[model samples]
Each structure stands twice: as structure tokens, then as C-alpha cells.
Target: MDAPTVSRDFDVVVIGGGHAGAEAALAAARVGARTACVVIDPAAIGRMSCNPAIGGIAKGQLVREVDALGGAMGQVTDVAGIQFRMLNTRKGPAVRSPRAQCDRVVYNREMARRVVEAPGVEVVAGEAIELLVEPGASGGSRVRGVRLGDGSEVLAPAVVLTTGTFLGGRLFAGEWEEAGGRMGEAGAARLSRSLLALGLELGRHKTGTPPRLCRHSIDFDRLEVQLGDDPPQPFSFRTGRLDIEQLPCWITRTNAETHRIIARHADRSPMYRGRITGVGPRYCPSVEDKVMRFADRDAHLIFLEPEGRDLDDIYPNGISTSLPPEVQEEFVRTVPGLEGARILRHGYAVEYDFLKTHQIRADLQVAGVDGLYAAGQINGTSGYEEAAAQGLMAGANAARAAQGHGPFVLDRASSYIGVMIDDLCRVNPDEPYRMFTSRAEFRLLLRSDNADRRLTPIAEELGLVSAEDGERTGRKERRIRAAVERLRSVRQGERTLEELLRRPEVEIDDPAIAAALEELGLAADEASEVEAEVKYAGYVARQAAQVDRMRRLEARSIPAGFDAASIRGLSNEARDRIARRKPLTVGEASRLPGVTPADVQVLLAALSGGR
Candidate 1:
């Protein structure tokens, strides 16, 4: 055999090219790192591994935050999105979110194009089989590079693992099983072993996708049509306008017959048969699980969403399963408006390994290892938006670490991304972690419309924001400030426009407010944002005060490399957990599972020169 090929060095190396890896590579390169994205198939970058959509509820807020941070997900969706809707329009401003159904093929193409054309990024078609590390003087290992399948070794100071579900992946369809990350993709078995050897704890999680039906076979006349918003709202602050034609999705329901068919085949499911030992997500349960758990319910909604404009496949949402092919066919016929449904692909569940998030820092760096980071599904988060957010943070911080910069950490009071990172580091989620409005205590300050305000400045500080992006951000800020000042100066019925907006019955589009907005030349979306700020001013102030009080606890710092085992007045369990996690602050130690408020007080007193 010929000698193994050794590739040139890069500053940062990113493995796996899904949403997480794609964003990671892009962010690293944009931040001036010589980055390489190693993937099984270069063309599969940012492939929609599950549904053909992005953003929903709290997830939408994350996508906006990613865009604000000079990341590519938001801009890409603007180009590939086929349908857009603003969720929670009837709810409070803090809860409203924008979701988009994208054309899968176009999304992948655009994402790959970005990775390929990025200035300092190189896309390499190779599978990484091993992680190379060297022992540091401090008795810890630091990442040196990764070994690829083609007998080529790529060297880098920092390595980001956005491996997604490919790490020891196994797919199941009823009684049938195969080793695959996605439908036709191979699993990363060797890398999983390498990770185990490196001493990182791994746990298994299972996620499923619904079957794809032929669009031509479905009778859409009997289904309810769901149209896009009248004036579609783009996810990115930089997207000037969406000029493409919109598509409408259809809604159908599974009837009693559908339930009966699913129930009869429940025993054949890998999940129910005990063939799959991995824990599945509780929030997005499969059809069989839902049917058995909610036997009293008569029907469940099934959305018939088009996969792409050119593709004939339809994604049926809310019925993900891993049942036999025959059972899937029989159940499709039982659903309303799907009597003649043709299966383009069978729904299957994939079980894969994920590292426990407690081993990760708020900056996305893996604990006890220098120059190594983990993000995306490997961190146990369930949504594409969540993965991309983590990837952006991880990639940027990894590049910074390689350059000897301080670790970049977001505070919980600032953005939803901060809350997510804090949650991952503080608690080990029993189920797959998916973001929701209820999880964010400071939702009022983390509204979807203002992610740019909260994060772009930070991105600029980190050298991720470009000149063009900074200019756009500046323009938007000016308009918002101008509009708010105009509103504050004008009076409507004895109250200023800003004060009038605080009334529950008033809207930004009210005659007086609209005329003022027109004079100020503010866009409709911009006006809505100003309206939210004015209406929620008091609540925002109150939340900010609470944040100030909490920051005192955060300010009480613990010494570096502080040993929890050395502290007194702590429970055994609390000591064990704190020692393993190595929390940096007294506040972080206070949030450990078994740690009590009294324990926190004792730790604070001890750190402040008390016994």
C-alpha cells in the first residue's frame, strides 16, 4: 500500500456538514480562520435531514439570532423558503415567531454553495475516522487533528464535532434494521469508538420522520388549504424582500380507521417491540405512540406539505412512525384526503449517540479538552434552528480559542441563545431538548424581532459581522430610533403615540399611529417592533431589574480549578455533581441538581473568606 496522505494544516476543522457543521464552517471561515468542512458527501451540506422546514415557536427566535450573528441559516432560508407564516399572531409579542417551509433541494444547494464559496473555508469529501490529540503539560489532552477514511490526515489546532446523528447511527423500520445516519447515508461507527476512547460519555437518542407521499396521488380537494401570510415576513434582517411565488399547504386528519390500523401494528414498531433502546423525544411523539397514549381522541391533524416545487413528494406532518410498509400503506388509505396516497419513502426511526450536555461549557467547548468543541444533535438538542445556533457559537469560539482570545459567553438576560446554553450546561435534559417560550424567563427582552439588536453588536466585536452587515444593522437601528422618537413626540387623544400604544386595544396601524409611521418611513415589520417595545416597556423594565438582581449571584465568582470536594456543608450528591461539572461561578454551582440554596450560601461565604 502507498503511504497515507497527510493534508495541509488548517486553523479550525469541522466534521459533518449538516446544518450544524455548515454553520460552524461558515462562521469559522468568516471570522478569519482557515477552516475545512469534512463530510461523507460534499453535496449533502445543510441537507434537510427531517422535515422540509425551518423555524417554529421558540425555534424561530433562534434562527433570527443566528442571522443576527452573521450566520448563513436565515439568509439561506430567505432564498429557499416556499411558505412563510408568523405564528402566535394572536398571542403576546414576546411569543410571536416566524416559520418557513423551504424547498429541500434548493436549501441544500444554496448551503453547499455558501460553504464552497466562503473565503477561508474548504469543503473536503471524506469521513473522519479518528480524533488526534496530544497530552498537554497541564495533564489534559488538546486536539491536534482528525484522521479521514481516505488514509488522509488533516491537522488543525481546533476541531468542532457537529457529527449530528451519524455517530453510531442505526435506523429502524418495523422489524427491519440497518446502519445509517439518514435514509441512504452510512453511519460513523469508527468515530464513535474514537470518541468513547477519549473518555466522553455518550447516550443514545432516537428521532423519527414521517413517510413521504406522492403529491399527484393525494386528493387535495377534500383537504383544508393553509395559505402563507398575506405579506410574508422574512427571517433575516438583511433580506430586503421575498419576490418568489408562494405555495399553500393542505391539512388532513387521521380518522378512527387510521387509528385502528396504527394500533394493530403497534407491537411491530421497533420502539414498542423493545428493539430500540434509545430514548425518543417526548414533545414530538410518533403516530403509534400518540394513538396508544391518547386513545380517547378521535383524530389527529396531518399536514400535507410539499417537499419542493419540482419534487412530487409530500411530507405528512404529525404522523412520524417506523411501522411496516404494509401498515403504513393501510393507514394512509384510512386518513381523510389520502385514500389513494402513494408512498415515495417509508418513515423510519434512527437511533444515534449524543454526548451529555453537562460536559459542555456555555461557549460550546467540551470540558477537560482544549481546542475541541461539540454542537448540534450531538449536544442533545432536537431542532435544526437549535443546532445551527450552537454551531455558530461553537465555531466562532473555537476560532477565538485558537487565537488566544477569551471564551465568548452569552448571558441569559440578553438572548434566548444564552438561556439555551445555560440550560444545557446546568441540567442534563432527560428528553431531547427543544426550545419553547415557557423556558425563557426573560422572553420580554428576547423577542424575535429584535435579535439583531441583542446579538449583532456582539458579532461585530468578534469580527464575524462584515462591513455590509454592519451597515444594514446601523440603518435598521437608526430607523427604529427615529420611529420611536416620532411616536413619543406625537399625541393621540391626550396621550402621546407611545403612551397610546401601551393600551391593549391600540395597534401600531391605528389611524394616528399609521400616519406617524408613514411620515417616518418605517416598514410594516419595523413599525410592529416599535409598537411591541412601546406596549411592553413597563414589563421590559421590570424584567431588566430582575436580571440586575440575578447578576449579583453571577458576579460572585469561584476560583479557577476550584475543587468542590474541598468545600464543606455540601451534600454528597451535590459535591459529586459539582466536581464533575466544574461550574465557574457560585451561581452555576447553585443550579446543580442536588445543590441546595443553603449550599450556595455556604459556598459564597467560603469563597468570600469565611470558614
Candidate 2:
């Protein structure tokens, strides 16, 4: 028998082509690594497996950060966005976010195009079933390559597992169960076995999507229209403006009748029927869960979102479920404006394997496994933004490790992405983790508008951002500084424009302020940033002070291979947790579960070599 054909060696192998896989492969290749992205289907590389929306609340900040780090999500969303809105526009700048409803086909196509066109990136059509590993000099096995289902092997020093909801995936619809990932994709059943065999513990997580309905079948006249933002802002800094035609979404409320239908069939839902044992995102509950949990509420809002400009399918946004097809149709028809709606597809739940993130270090590398990394849903995160951010970090770190460079670490104070990773690794979330603006303690400084300011220079230093991108970012920064100076110098009444703008009643659009911004040639977005920074300066400074004090603990690095078990005063739980997590900094150790402040004090003394 002939041996299976073997591919040439690669510097990095990215498994699965979901959001995380796409960003990981692109980032690694962009960093000059010889990277190969192995996917079950090349055409479905960036398929929007769930909702076709990008960025919301804290998630928007993440996408911005990813873009600033030279990731592709922001750009793709710009091209595919149909309806753009700045969420929380009336709120403080810290919570203000940009969200876009994307044309799923366009978004996926654009991402796939970029991935396939990326330099040094190879799109390999295959299902990776196993990781090739060999005993390492450091005691643990080192990742060598990946083994595909076709029996072909592609050797690489680094491998990023971003398999998403495909590993050991099992879909549930009412009492029905099937082995699949997304709608039509196959589950990577063999890969789950491989991970388990490697002694990696895997947890189960489930997420569901709302049913897609035929657009023509819905009664739109009865629903309230939600218009896109006028002069919409694009997610990418590279995008000057979004000139694409905007589409309107319709808002309709689920009536008591709708709730009754769902309640009657609640027990039939896979999510409620004991069929799905995996934990789902508590923040994004299903219709059944919503009805059961929020029983006092008479109705719920559902946004009828267009799937695409050319497509006739509509997504009912707020009623995701895993109920039967008939039940779905019945409840959907009971909605205020969906009385005649026809189901394009029934919503279903997918339970898949995810690695307990605590086993994954802050840099996204799997603990005790050299050259192996994990990202996205596989890392127990619930959103595309979270996955992409993790992918960027994991891929960059993997490349750095392959090239003998140091791992890139981000702290909670610097970026929302940093806060997310820190939270994931230390919290060891029991439910699927989702990002929220409330999660960031220093969100005032990590606003979506200034993501580039916080991350671009660092990305440039790491070779992830291009010189041209760096120059553009520098120019923007200069414009912002000049604007700030002018605002401070120009006086209206006894107060300078900056001081006046700080007043709650004084608006940035006031005659004097607008005139100054116009004369400076400062764009509205730029002016908004300047105003926010100045107005919130005192609050931001206080937050920065807190961050600085915390940085002392963060700067104190725990010795590599430190014996946490030997710590004399720690509780048994703290000792075990610290030993298992191997936290690199005193800050990280303090955040770990079971490690109390007193334990941290003890740790501080012991690590200082004074205990």
C-alpha cells in the first residue's frame, strides 16, 4: 500500500476556519510565518454560524482593538455592513459602541478572500483529526504538526486549534439530536478524541441562533422601523466613510400569545428538556429560557433583521431557540408583526467541546503543551469578537514562539481584550463567557474610539502592523493633540473651550465649539474623542491612578516553575489553583479562584524570598 501523501513543512498550522481560525491564520502569515489554515470546507471559511451581526457594547471595543492590532474583522464588517449604528450613543463615551448588521454572504466571502489572498497563508481543505506531537526536552510533548482525516500529515512547529463549535459537536432541536457543527457542517468528532487522549480536559458549551424567516411572509406594516445611523461610522479606522446603501430593520414585540405558545412547548425545547447538558450563555438566553426566567414580563422585543440585500431571508433576532420546527413557527407567528411569517429554518442548539480556559495561559497557549494554542469557542468564549481577539493573540504568540521571540502579554488596564483574557484564564467561567462594558474597570480609558491609540504602536513593535498603518495612526494622533491644544487655548466667556466643554450642559456641537472644530478641520469623530477625553479627564485620571497602583503587583513576576505547593501559609485550594494555573504575575495569582487577599500577601512575602 502507498503511504499517505505528506505536505511540506509549515511554520504554523491553524485548525478550523471560523472567526478565530481566520484571524489566527492571517495574523501568523502576516507576521511572516509560513502558515496553513486547514478547514473542512474552504468556501465556508468565515461563515457567520450564528447571527450575522458584528460588534455591540463591549464587543465593539474588542473589534476595534483587533483592527488596531492588524486583524481583519473590522475591515470585513465595513465591506459587508448593511445597517450601522453607534449603540449607547446617549451614554458616556466609555460605553458608546459601534454595531453593524452585516450581509452574511458578503462578510463570509470577504473574509475568505482575505484569508486565501494573505501572503504566506495556505488554505488547506481538510479536517484535522489529530495533532502530531513528540516528547520534548522540557518534559511535556511538543506539537509537531496536524494529521488530517485523509491520513495526510502537515508538519509545523506551532498549531492553533480554533475548531470552534465543531469539536465533538452535537446539535439539538426539540427531541432531535444530530452530529453536526453549524447548520450543515460536520463535527470534528475524531479531534475531540485526540484532545482527550492528550490528557486535555474539555468542557461542554451550547449556543443557539434564531430562525431565519422568509422576508415576504412577514407583516412589516405592523412593526416599528429601526433606521440605521445617519452618516454611519465604520468599524475600521482604515474606512473613511460608509457609503453603502443602508437597510432598515423592523422591531416587533412578542405578544402574550407568543409567550403562551413558547410556554406550552417549553418542555419540548432541547435546552429545557435535559437534552442539552452543556452550559449556554446566560446573557443571551433562548426564548424558552427567557419565558421561564422572566415570567412576569408580558412581552419581548424581536428585531426582524435582513440577512442580505439580495436575499429574501430575515432573521428574528431576539427569540433564539432549540424548539421543534412546528413549535417555532407557531410562536413566531404569534409575534405582533410576524403573524404570517414563514420559517426559513428552525433554530437549533449546538453542544460542543471547549477547553477549560484556565488550562490556557494568558498568551492563549495551552498549558503544559508546547507550540499548541487555542482560541474562539474552543476557548469557551461565546462571541465572534472575543474569538477573533483571542485568535490574534494566540497566532501572534505562536509565531513569536516559533521565531524565538517573547510572548506578548496585555494587562486588564491597557485594553478590553486584555481584560477578557485575564478574566477568562483566572475566572474559569462556569457559563459561556461573553464580553460586557461593565466587565472593564478602566473602560473609560479603553473606549472604542481610541483602540488604535492604545494598540497600534504596540502592534507595530511586534511587526503585526505595517509602517504605512503606523504612519496613518500617528497622523490621527497628531490631529487629536492639535485639536486638544486649540480647544484649551480658545476661550469663550471666562472659560477656555476645553473647560466649557467639560460642563454637563455645554455640548461639543455648541456654536463656539463647532466653529473651532471646523476651523481645525477636525472630523466629528475626532472632535468627539477630544471632547470625551477632556470632559472625563479627572475620572480617567483617577482610574489611571488605580491602574498604576495595581501595576505594582502586575509588574512583580512570579518565578517560572515556582512551586506554589511549597507556599507555607496558603490554603489547600489556593495552593492547588496557583500550582495548576502557574500564574506569571502576582496580579494574576491574586485573581485566581480560591486565592484570597491574605493568600496573596503570603505569596508576596514568599516570592520576595523573605518568608
Candidate 3:
């Protein structure tokens, strides 16, 4: 005697409503797909489980690209942000990025509202216990939908898994362990087995957060106050102004004593105790890792960030740990301003299952499984921005696949999203993958200020952007072109205005350049973009030529199921690697590990019927 299974239908079914799932569902619905987002709790959609902030370093460029593609992250960040600052202001335009401190609760609520109000999207409360699969036309497995914990099914042609850290998640602090993604939320215990049953390879990754401090307990007088910019820049291109009241974040440092205490009790940490086998993010290491790796440094800077305008908890940006509660308290008290701080919640590490990147195609579709996609932490990425970008692409591609359309793929030259996906597909990261400006070879063309210029037209053609937004982008482009043309035409005593801009001393706001730009009625952002283009025109052209050369290789398609064993002169290592990766293009095959330049030349010769 079992309960009857209640079956429902949707064009696309998205599992987990975190940052990735929310974007997936929204993007699917935006493309006119009947989408359903299944989550353990509907209220947790877009929850900032790690930090109460969005966009930092290379991450800000990602948010702008997501916005240009009509994704909700940048707009939602603009609405929920409490403080905004443009990082790397003194550096060149290529590395300058926007960061925003947000109200965590408000961000979650606003993102959930967007998902709920989105047409053709239904938010369903349930844990996905199993993936419903059927025999594919090619005698392989294909995902048909998902089976919820209640023995009900949401049937769809496509399924997207943006499970974050919830799939077989285990939280650890000292000797205590629990089956949960976050502190209070339960993990999807059964989902990992379902993926394993499909013959998908899974790897483990660990990430930790710092303890939240009771704001009233901290001594504000001892801290060095860091204020937001006077005219804070917005993350979203559509956001006209930031009218919210900005708050100040404070900084303190961990002294030698703090490091000593952590070193003394390091064995109590789950990671140190040999209880956690997963590899964590190397860029954002835990406190114990930091101390052990950089023992030469006696102090590490910590920023005390506000969680929200109405909340009393402060998030310490640095010193994330999984030490025992008492040790956490003891080490935290050694810091300058936190001498008497009360821990609202103790930090802990969570280890979860993620699919090996090589199993997914460029469009995020599972290589051997049809109608199945994965994004977010499930794909071994670390940040919310990376997750959202993948989710947008996955959801849009899923919808298109369901409508009998070809896959929509982005190249590394187009945007950061493209760069990230290219890296993920070409290389299997051993640790959690995080975005950085250095990761892109053509970073000069991938600046944060010009994401809209780089990607808006493609998004509009894909039906991800509104006609009005598309027209706005077109108008901005025209103005920039006209301004550049005018600069080239207007000559100074010895050089044109464009030539003056190329000089290191002359800025966009210089008297002569400012007057000329003002005549064209260009906004501050547009004028700045013009300046960057004029200044780096030569470098940009060189990179564009490199991109063109790469595109020629990418255009040479590698037929599916093509056997590398037939190609003579390939090294055994290259043959084995190519066979396992199954690269879809000659360009991808060239980028695979162990596949040398000689190997690429051999591959080209074999494909072209040459020696």
C-alpha cells in the first residue's frame, strides 16, 4: 500500500532555488518555456549563504555580463545593495570592478519576488529525490523530469540541477557533523545516489564561512572605518541611480597571538582532523590554512561588514574557519576591535558533491545524457556570479532545446561568461573554480565598463532582452561611435583629441576632451568607455586579431564520436585524453591537457587528409 504518485508537467524543471536555480527558472520562463523551480524552501531563493555582498574583483564584471544578457542578478543587486564601491580605481580600466555590500534578507526577498512574479514560472516546494530518466533515441539515458520527496513527479523535456551545496552535503565543525548544506537547512541526501546511478562522476568540494558577530558587542572606536564612494556606481546598466543610504564597513587585523591560538587548536578543525576530504577554494582559504601557509605574516586584515541595515550581525570578511566554538571565540577575541565580541553564529565547513566538469558540454548539457543540465556549486564553481551566469545559459539553452532549436554557445572572446565556460569545459579544476581578470587573455576587451557593449546585441537576438533595452543599447553604441569619430576628426595643435586621450596624463575628463564629450551629451559611463577604447585601441586590435585566429580553429568542427585511435602520430597520452574529453571542436582538442602543439598539428593534418 503506497501513496499514488501525483504527476505534473512543465517545459523545464529546475531543482534548487538558490542563485543558480532562480536565474535558471527566470531565464527559461523569459524564453516562453513553462518552467517550474523546485526547492526545499521557496523563501531561500537567491540567498547569499556565504557573504552578504555581491560583485568583487573579477566577479563584478560577471554581474554586468549577466545583466547585459537580461539576467536578474545585477538588477536585483542594485535594488538590495546597501553600499557600493568601484574597486581598483587607481588601476587601468581593464581591472577596475564594482562591488556592493547588500542587505542579505532584502536580497533574498527581492529575488524570490522576481521569480514568483515571472510569467510561466511556478515555484514548487519540495526536495528532488530522484531524476526521472528514460531510454534515449541513441540507446543512452535521458532525463525526463524529477521525482519529489512526496512520491510526486514534475515531468518535463529538460531538467536543470542547480543544487548548490545541498547534494549529499555534510557540515563539519570540530568533531560535530551534520547532514546539511547550510547551518539549519537539510541536504539532499538521496540526490547524489541518483546521479551516481546515471554513471555521472562526482567529486567533493569544501567551503567555509566566518562567524557572524553581534554588532553591539564590538568596539567600533578601535576599528578603522572604510566608507563607500561619494558617488557610488551601480552594478546594473539599467539602474539610473542609487538612492539608498550607504553604510560604512570597518577593518581590523589578526595579530600574532590570534594566529598562535589558531595554530595551537588547529587539530580541532575538521579540515585538520582529516575528517574533510574535499578540496576547498585556494584563493579564499580558511583561517587555519592562511596561518599555516603564510606563517611569515603576523597579521591578516579582516573587514567587519554589516549584514543588513536592520540586523545587528556583522560578517567578518576574512578568517573563515571550522574551528571548535570555544577556539573560534578565543581566536576572534584576540583581534583589535573584536576583543569583546559575541559570536551570533559559529563558522563551519560544508563538503558536498559536484559533477566533474568534463561530463558537461559547452552549453552545460550533460555529455551523455540528453535534456539534463547542471550549474552552480554542482558544477564545482565557487561564487554566486559564476553560478548565475551558468544558470542563465543552461536555462536558456534548455528552453531552446525543448523548442527544437540548436544550442546557443558563447565563445571566450565575447564575455566573461564565455571565458568561464570555456575554462570549465576545457580544463578539469581540482579545487573550486573562481573567476579572476588574469584568467582572460583578452581582458582588455573584457572590461567591466563595456559588458553591455560586448554582449547586449547577442542577448537581444537570443530573446533574452526586451526590445526597449535593446534599443537603449543601440542608442548608447551610436553615441560612443559618434564621439569616437568626432575625437579622431578634431585636431589639437599637433595631435587629434583621440591622440591626446592615448597619452597617459590626459584623462576622459580633461578640459578639452570633457568639453567635446559634453557636446555629444554622453553620460559618464559612456564617456569613460570612449576613453578606454581610445586609449587601448592598439592593444584591443591585437587581441581582436588573436580572437579571429582562434575562431578559425573553433569553426573547424570535430564530428561527434570521432575516434582519435584512427589518427596516426598522436601520442598515447593525447589519444587517451582526447577520447575521454570528446572535444567537439579542433580548438577544444588543442586546449586539452597533455595535447601539445605538435598534437594539434597532427589533428589538423588528419582532419584535412594531409600527412
Candidate 4:
């Protein structure tokens, strides 16, 4: 033995230091596989590239999934969040979500610390030039390792490419075009070419951030103070019920004057003037797009948020721009809340190379190659919450694959994480995908409150969650069942949890639990539980039936090496997609839009005939 081959090799090697890579490398390590994170800078690990915060609207569910599986994002958000708000309280459980504004410095520090402290992870700073592939059986490519620019070869059984905004990343604002990723960092120039060389379909996407304004220069008296919840809620279930010191945020609006200024400078705007080359997110548009699209609206809400407790930087949430400096200053001055606010950094849009999500499976594994995966913005998704969720799933599955275990997939009814992944695999968004409440077909069953209820068991199977998490799931499940039983057992005319939740006037307690402790307080807890379960009980049951039906089809697995071309009735697109994708089950096959029900029947017929 020549001293055990001097080069360090691991079971999984995660590329990129953003949200996805941090979660992916950490998950694989936590699941007991040796993991290495190849990054550009150690200080920037888990950096919030677009914004310095976590959890909002539909995104909160993704954070919850990370928490349920023992990932670090939830913990970091809980610790560093400055302002915490639960949105859509008037809506049902599925639509209700928790949003937080974090001190950016604290958030990144917390995440980086967790990644370094993880059991089986090593973080190295460098750039991967290309991948090394060896020919496996039947013409499939087996990944050997990644070669870095510094001339070091990192070997592993598997590779997860989370090259967010680094694959030939280019930025354009008006006449200016630069070679960089986010924050003027050196990007992966050759890695995108290397991936395309491996025959993956790549696309381009652009996203922008608002210029950071000096906190001291802003007129605080003009803005409305929006404080965090009285009793703040933490994103991580692992965090004990209480914490010290909650942070507050301010809210303001961009008036007609502000919109007019942005419109006047629209010629200089990169988005409309055709200076930027890639598609931007639809939901989050630049000030120019918002003004152009909603001309009738007089004002748009803008949130004044702190980047971190230590830094003087503040993120102006609603006014993402790629305008010139003079135009930005004029527009900032026109806004009701931001008058005389001095800009610290210029807001600009970055265009980066991305993959058409169909190139990878829901588990983030790439086609035509064993032990190769992708996640985060690389997979054509936006937002840190979205990236972290994808990374967690990919990391756990990669770990399971290394252990010779099954792939970890959480279905749509189970978690918003499932809906996000499924949408990536099935819906194939035309633009950069961001999570919205409308994305899920079975959202009624997937709520932020119950992420552990739906996904902790599966996470346990993947060994991403500790054995103790099983108890968290059990306690919640028991409480849910107890409430349901009491609902069914109670007599008519007398108030029940279901009855109380439906009544506008009758709350958890008709007397309201806080004041009327003398009477049976069980009704309040009962109402809370029933409100969660019964909000869309009918819709949830329907989705459950669909899931059950799909699982039955999934259970009837075709043997490995089964060919899709041999099956009849598959449409040309379906046949081509299935052949390239090699989906694991009939259910997965059915999820692909081009693959029809008839194709599934044909596959069933082919498998039965061979049997």
C-alpha cells in the first residue's frame, strides 16, 4: 500500500459556497458520508447573495423543511432574524407563512459556523475547472472527480454541482458589461463550458438587487415602523420556544413621483432597454417594470430592512434596480421614505448561466452520468430559501445513494419542499422560478406548521434528522389525533373544535383562552389543532387519495435498465424525455407533462409482458 493514495477522496463533493452548497455538503456529512465543499471564498460561505434574510410567503415552508431535516438555515434565520412576521393570517393553513428579516452578517456567520462544525465536512477554497469522467457499464458516464484551477484533483464517488451564478456569469447594466458573479467575485469561466461539453442544456437568467442605502442618512420619521411579533416565532423547531431581543423593520411606499422618475430613466434601465441578456423573475421586477406594468397604482410598498445588526447597510426591498448611479439617486430621493438617503453600493443586475431544470431529476441528479447532481440557482430557481431546500434534498439523496439506500423524495402533499422540487421537475418554469402559494396543487396538506409532521420520518430514513426528531414528529402527530378524536366524539349543539373554528365570533374559546382559564381550556388547543387540520380537510383528503394512487403506481417499479423506446403509445416528446430522464417509477413518469397517461399504460403493458 503506497500510503493510502495521498489525495483526499470523499463520498460526496459539493461545488459552490452559496445556500445550496452549504446545505448539500452539510446534509451529506450529517448523514454520515465524508463530504468536501469546493468554494470560491471561505468567508462568503452561505452568503445571502440576493438579500440578507430568510423565509417569506411560500418560502417559509422550505425553511421548515430544512429545520425538519436538521439543516442549518432555519437555525441561522431564527438566531439572526431582525423582524419576524406571519403573512396571510386571514388565509387558511396552506397559505399562512412565516417571513423573517435577518441581520445578514449574523446569518452568514451562523451558517458558516454550522458547516465547519459538521461531523464529516471539509471546506476548501478554489474553483473547479472541469469534471473527470470514466466510462461505466452500458455507455453511462461515471464521475471520477473534479479538477480545480489550482491543479488539485478532488475525487469522490459523487459530485453535486451548485455553481450558482458562476457558470460563465456576466453582468450588464446600461453600457457596462463585466465578468463576475454576485458581489464582483470571480466566476466559473470554464466550468459552464465543461458542463455543456458533457451535453447539458444551459440557459441564462438575470436577477437584480437594490442599492444598499446608509442607515444613518435615511429619514426614519417618514417611515412606518413594523415590529416583529409580540412573541416571535423561530424558523427551526430545534430552537427552544424563547429567545432574547427581537428586531423591527420599517415600511414605506414609492409614490407617483418615484415611479415617474424611474419611468423617465427607463431608457437607462437594463431590463427594458435590452442591456441585460437573461430573463428576470416575474414576481420580483425592477422599479421600471413595476411602473410600466402597474401604471394606475399610485404607490408600491417598500420595506426598509437592515442587512445586519453590526452593519450600517439597509436593503430597500421593493426597489430592485439596474439603473445608473445618478438615476438611482434621483429615484431614491423621490420615494416617500428614502428622501436624502445616501447610496452605499450601486444596485445592478447580474446575468449568469443556468441549466434547463429538465436536465436533472427531482433528486437533483444529472442525466447520462452516475454520481453527478445539481442544485440552487444552477437548477434555475431563485431565493435563498428555494436554494437551501433543493440543496437539502440533493445532499440527502446523494448520501443515500452512497450508502446503497433509496432516493429520498417528499411528495407534494408532504412538504412545500416537495412541491418546489416537483415543480422544477414537472412544471419547467418559463422564467426563473420563485416559490408562490399558487405553485402547489396539494398545498392544503402542506403547511409550515406541519413540515415535521409530513417530512421528519422520511428525513429520519435518510439519516439527515437525528433520532430525537422522531419524537418531535410523534408528539405533533399525537396532538393532531387527539384533537380530531375529541372533534368526532363531541355531541351536537354543544361547541366543538370544528364548529368553533368555522364560527367568526367563536374563537379557540368563545371566552378566548387567555381570559377564560376557569372553563375547560382544552377547546382552545383543540381549535388550534382543528384549524390546522380542517382548514382544507376536504382538499387534503382528495390530495391524499391522489398520492395514494400515485404510490401504488410507484410501487410497481420496472426493472433497472428498462428502455422507454420499447414501450408503445409514448408521444415523441414523452419517449425522448423518459429515455433521457429514466424516471424511477410510473408515478414519476406521469409527473412529466409530455409523458401521458397512455405512455404509463404502455409501460405497464411492457413490464407485464416481460414478466
lDDT top scorer: 3
Off by over 4 Å in 4: 1-6, 492-505, 511-527
Tens-digit lDDT track for model 3 on 1-611? 15637889999999989988999999999888999999999989999998878998999999999999999999999988889999998999999999999999999999999998999999999999999999986456889999999989999999999999998999998889999989899999799999999999999999999999999999999889999987888898899988878999999999999999999999999998899999999999999999988999989999999999999989999989999999999999999989999999999999999999989888899877889999888999998999999999999999989888777778888888988988998777899999999999899999998999888898898889898889999999999999999899888899999999999999998898887777789988898899999999999999999999988888777776678987889999899888877777788888887999899999998888786
Candidate 3 regions with alpha-carbon error over 4 angstroms? 1-4, 559-579, 598-611
Q: Tens-digit lDDT track for model 2 on 270-344? A: 877788899999999998999999999998889889989899989888899999988998888878778888888
* Clash totals, every prediction: 0, 0, 0, 1
* TM-score list, all predictions: 0.96, 0.97, 0.97, 0.94
Q: What is candidate 4's TM-score against the reference?
A: 0.94
Q: For model 4, how big is the CA root-mean-square deviation?
A: 3.1
lDDT of 1 by residue, 79-170 (tens): 99999999999998899999999999999999999999999999989999998899954467888999999888888999999999999999
**Higher TM-score: candidate 1 or 3?**
3
Q: What's model 3's lDDT at 65?
A: 94
The local lDDT score (0 to 100) that residue 233 gets in candidate 3 is 85
| Candidate 1 vs 3: which has more lDDT | 3
lDDT of 4: 0.80
TM-score of 1: 0.96
TM-score of 2: 0.97
